[model samples]
Target: MDQSISSLHMRKLCPNLEREDALDTVLEVPLPEEMFPNRKGGSSSSSTDQDNHYAWLKSQAFNKATDTPPPMLSGRTAELQLLLSVIGSPLIPMPVPFDTAFSNRSVCESSIQASTAKYILQQYIAATGGQAALTSVQSMYVVGKVRMSSSEFHMGNDNSSAAAAVPPSITRNGKSEIGGFVLWQKNPELWFFELIMAGCKMSAGCNGKLAWRQSCSEKSHASRGPPRPLRRSLQGLDPRSTANLFVDAVCIGEKIINDEECFILKLEVSPNVLKSRSASSFDIIRHTVWGYFSQRTGLLMQLEDSHLLRMKSGCSRISASTQISCKSINNDSSIFWETFMESIIDDYRYIDGINIAHNGRTVVTLFRYGEGSINHKRRLEECWTIEEADFNLHGLAMDSFLPPSDLKVDCD
Candidate 1:
């Protein structure tokens, strides 16, 4: 008998004796391109054989390995492995270069900063569409579902075990409508909120002087009421006017981090601003990081936001981080022309040209305090597209409609 066959038979009979012949056979096989087909080409034999061999080898190695224990990983080691795996993965795309062909060393430092900020702002503006287009947008109707989760706090003697209990969860669906206008001698403005959340099922209008909200709940009769005075609510924040404000605010001094020059902007939330009804109930603290804009399109290529505060309790906090990029923008649309005309057709005098329409997706990662202790984090991963947007220059004025006599009024 051959020496290899005799050894194999002896190993099988003894069972306790470790098999060396099988190991030798695998080690002697050539692992070159000739033995394995090129992976780039579509081939079945190489991959199938490789998988089968690996599985067989792994099983055999573990079979008689009673004395050898599996490797144990510490928390830090596991984290490092995860980080390495993420960094090594091909799913993440490389960032676009920040330096532009128009970049010049001779440019003044201040001029460079201003030019860079302006270029970035323009890119963001153009990414949504040109400033002209954005300015013309008057009213936007958005119909989408919103998922909300709620948790009930539990009080117990056992602190550690109490924290381990699962929190109660609830979800709700809703939609929103937003309207924009020119205010304070034609300064651009914007206002929006969830219609259902406010407990009002009616339309609201503002014309700098007068403001109004009508309610049409099932319990209440259809009625048109006087506009609620939200001038104070309307005073400070205007998404359209603040577009440039955001650009300027984020155009802070530059610093080098990890050998890359980055512009860091600290966004602070004022208590006064928070107290205002216009502010959302949720906490939002935004710190934006900016890179140079593309010279050709004059749009921002990359933007990163750190420490996006969503909720805070005691010293514990929940936050999210985000990165946004504009892939493309289309300016020519016949549907836009039709929609713009139809919106202004009734009050032909008041409607203006379409100003801004944008569609994009954002990836958000939520984190909890105590190093992932609290489980209040979620991705809520969603993509939003702006389907219809129209801005009316002349405001529409509706005649007063009376409330129904048999309305069920809740005076609680």
Candidate 2:
């Protein structure tokens, strides 16, 4: 073959190959088989096939260099944002005095379990810092570092040989990414949370009237559900909020965790709250929360909750301009995704007389399956440590917690 013609052919085979390299790098090989002995045969078929494969490999490498990040890596940006909002943010303590309710709950009228739970919570209040100390704080600021990772697993048995041979993309051991977050909060539903990970910033804040989330390269979006307290508040970050959340909860039982006896107080979301959170496309089946208060120290050692969501697809019709036919989706048998999270609180250290969990670990399991689809499980984990915390910040203001200007406040 003519040398110039061969170069042109090579360039055509791989679009990404540079023009100069394609023309100048071609060598007149004395023995092609010696160079690539893996070729099945020295026939025209093998030679052409081998060349095509090489071209493909080169194209893939070129594309990878220029392509956007892998979905898993880019997806972490959003995940970290959610992590900060759910576990990193500090929630403002309700202004209501803790003693008012305690004094009203007659010991004789309440059930044994309920009364016991209340008494335990009072001890928690004292351990966290007395009611006077807790109520004295009007605002909080916190900074922390975290390492987080997420991976999926298969839950059900699949006997197919193909399935058995193709292992999951995520392995038994995976790498985690390091990130940092800062949070600010004031009394009565004002807070801000920001997390930076992998060069992306995830942020969410509430200005008492509007709650929104904003991340890199995306406009802000309002959160679903009625105004709810941030979950991170209960993660030993704010003991007063934790006490209030379980004030009416019944002590379901006791279990030994990490070789320590703990009382389990269970709380389930009210039906009305669930209805307000659910939308046309999404139905919240249930949300239940549990707290594991260490019986030894009267402090919370762990927190857990699980929620199920039923997502219905194909319910809405396309715009008339689209000119397409659609079928109604049955909400009864819609796909379901459930999330369960358990956090182990440890390394409790006193910060300004308040017992704060400085270091903690959380394990999250996400189960996603349709009525007849293969079940897939994803396990996400996060290890967090509080780097700094302060109460009654010198200059924190409500204006600092204002929602982003670009937030989509119209979304239902």
Candidate 3:
């Protein structure tokens, strides 16, 4: 491989951080295993594979589209984009918020569990920051760093193997990919998120009415249902959205997490909402969210959500138009994939009188079922920390949240 190509790839991995945050700070992505010598002290054997990944990540056209939506990003590279950016996220996006996420539960007045959940949320609002403080700010932005990786995979009992061996491509410990993200939010419905990992930059945003996502060299795809909110935002970054998301939740019960007893609030996606997000090729069977609020502190300590998807048989390719999520799937048989994600929020500190979690870890499990002799389980995880956060910025306008020009809306 040309040395220039590798050097160029190195530069491409460097993110353009804010001027204040840029000094002495550099973004680092783990070099492909091929970059180093083999365990036997010989040259690594995977140079060709590494070169292709590097070349695609820094392709001039793709990077150009990331900075200014190129006139086109053809389908030729969609598979590569999907392979490099496989993240599992709920497809149903967040519901549109009214007065408040929690305040809209007047219809379910009779359920004792619902009332208990509401009370738990009310306490959370107070614990994070009083309603007065939370409502006082109109917008906020956060700068953070993240490491993501696919950690493990194993065949289910249906397969012949007693205990499936982990694939060579996957690190049993989920090899971590280091990157940084910049998040800007005006509200639950109007927001933008950009992330760069392994030298590829992917973005998802909602311009108040629509949510779309794009990976480098891939045309953007609008989400199917209502405007979406980035799941990362709800990870102790956006209190308002987090509060509103569980507004209709019912108290499922309590469980001790990390030695802290917490109240569990559960919410399920409505059938109509799921139907709206489903496309002809795939159906989102169910998506349910759970929030665990610390009983003693009255703050949310963890969040977990699981979603099941059934795709048309033989249509194996995961959609590239969706968020920089959706890892690859096998096409051998008609199968169902259930993705479960759990986020543990911690390192809380008061910023401007608001208690905010500065760091967290998320683990995602993707399980394949509905097919005998083909069940597989893959595990992925992400660790993230907030480096900077600020509220009430004056210059962030609706334009900041616009979708790309080449964006294709998937549904009405």
Q: Which candidate is the best by lDDT?
A: 3
Please give the distance, in angstroms, between residue 136's alpha carbon in candidate 2 and its true position after superposition. 1.0
For residue 355, model 1's alpha carbon misses the true position, in angstroms, by 7.1
Compared with the true structure, the alpha-carbon lDDT of candidate 1 equals: 0.26
RMSD of 2: 17.8
Q: Write the per-residue lDDT of candidate 1 for residues 100-193, one digit (tens) a residue.
A: 2123333354455555565555554554454666555443333222111112332323355334332221112112212111111122222222
Model 3 alpha-carbon drift over 4 Å, by segment = 1-93, 101-108, 157-174, 314-333
Best by TM-score: 3
> Per-residue lDDT for 114-135 in model 3, tens only?
8888788889989988788887
Please report how far candidate 3 places residue 119 from its true position, in Å.
0.9
lDDT of 3 at 101: 48
Measured by TM-score, how close is model 1 to the native structure? 0.34
Mind giving the per-residue lDDT tens digits that candidate 2 earns over 354-376?
88888889887767666543455
* Evaluation by TM-score, superior candidate among 1 and 2: 2
- Ten contiguous residues minimizing lDDT sum, candidate 2: 5-14
